[model samples]
Target: MSRPVDRESPDRLYTITSGRSRGGDEVFDAVTLVVAECDPTPGMQSEHSRILRMCQRPMAVVEVSARLGLPVNVVRILLTDLLDAGRITARHPTAVNSAVSPFASPDVLEKVLVALQKL
Candidate 1:
């Protein structure tokens, strides 16, 4: 008898990630953004190639996980491989004026204050 096919089988995931559970030294979260640094090469792993194609433009890690129908952790492992190969780059999202503070900009705070006063 033949074994049933399952896309998310543990064996499949394990094989894809080379039996590793954790990614490289770099930390990758769901909202982290990734971009392809170069085109996919022949004989590259299918998942890696697909990731490269998807990341032609900056794409969030969560979006990639959803699109590929894979768990976030699995995607992170794959991204780490590409990152190590220098085929992709990853970055966490940041606010426009993050250097100043976590609070909203002065203009936005003023608007909110005026609206509250009206109420």
Candidate 2:
């Protein structure tokens, strides 16, 4: 059977995030892998608890954002608090940001830029 949806009040997100636009100084890339550091308490915010549960087996930041239907930055902030509090470990999937295009290498990138300029 499919899992039931967990609906929240329209204002829930604002409350959860405290109206902040940034998560923290810790930069978690979209593909960063995160795992919960401990079992979340029932008293915690629903979003935090859900994130901890979903992260038990390791999940990417992008996956979490999509699952929770929250923007990437918002999720990052929540995760940053968790991480700073030692509640989770955010590991970058690779040394390079996956969002970067394959042609992003300086040599090829410059060549492409020059060609585009000529066009």
Candidate 3:
């Protein structure tokens, strides 16, 4: 027999977004960059504060999603609220030439690895 399922454990995405899917007028993509621009305001959720802390270093939407353990769409909704409140700004990443490989040099990779290890 299969083990029983725990139905109420996960904090469902819909609950986090207050039952909303779409964020707002602005659009967000996986690579969209976000930066925290202001302090937490009144009437904000704890998740919003967490998002602000994560965005302080200029993170992409997908990175934020992974770091925060939230779905991309749910993160988008939180980001939208921040955008509307003027607490964060979202912008697209710079375009790269199709012919050029995005990989960094070995030396740079080593430096990055060291830096990440320190973190």
| Best candidate according to TM-score | 1
| Count: clashes, candidate 2 | 1
* Ten contiguous residues with the weakest lDDT in model 3: 5-14
Candidate 2 scores a C-alpha RMSD against the true structure in Å of 7.8
Cα shift from native, residue 81, model 1 (Å): 0.4
Name the top lDDT candidate. 1
- Lowest summed lDDT across 10 adjacent residues in model 1 is found at 95-104
Residues 1-119, candidate 1: write the lDDT tens digits: 99876758899999999999988436788889999999999999999999999999999999999988888889999999999889999998985775576466777789889999999
**Candidate 1: where is the Cα deviation over 4 Å?**
1-5, 24-26, 96-119
lDDT (Cα atoms) of all candidates against the true structure: 0.89, 0.83, 0.80
Write model 2 residue lDDT over 20-107, tens digit each, in one string. 7676546798888999989999788888899999999889999999999887887888998898889998887657654586766788
- Structural similarity to truth (TM-score) of each candidate: 0.77, 0.67, 0.67
- Cα lDDT for residue 96, model 3? 60
Instruction: Give candidates' CA RMSD values in order.
Output: 3.7, 7.8, 8.3
- Cα shift from native, residue 59, model 2 (Å): 0.8
Give the Å error, residue 51, model 2: 0.5
> lDDT for model 1, on a 0 to 1 scale?
0.89
Better lDDT candidate (2, 3): 2
Clashes of each: 0, 1, 0
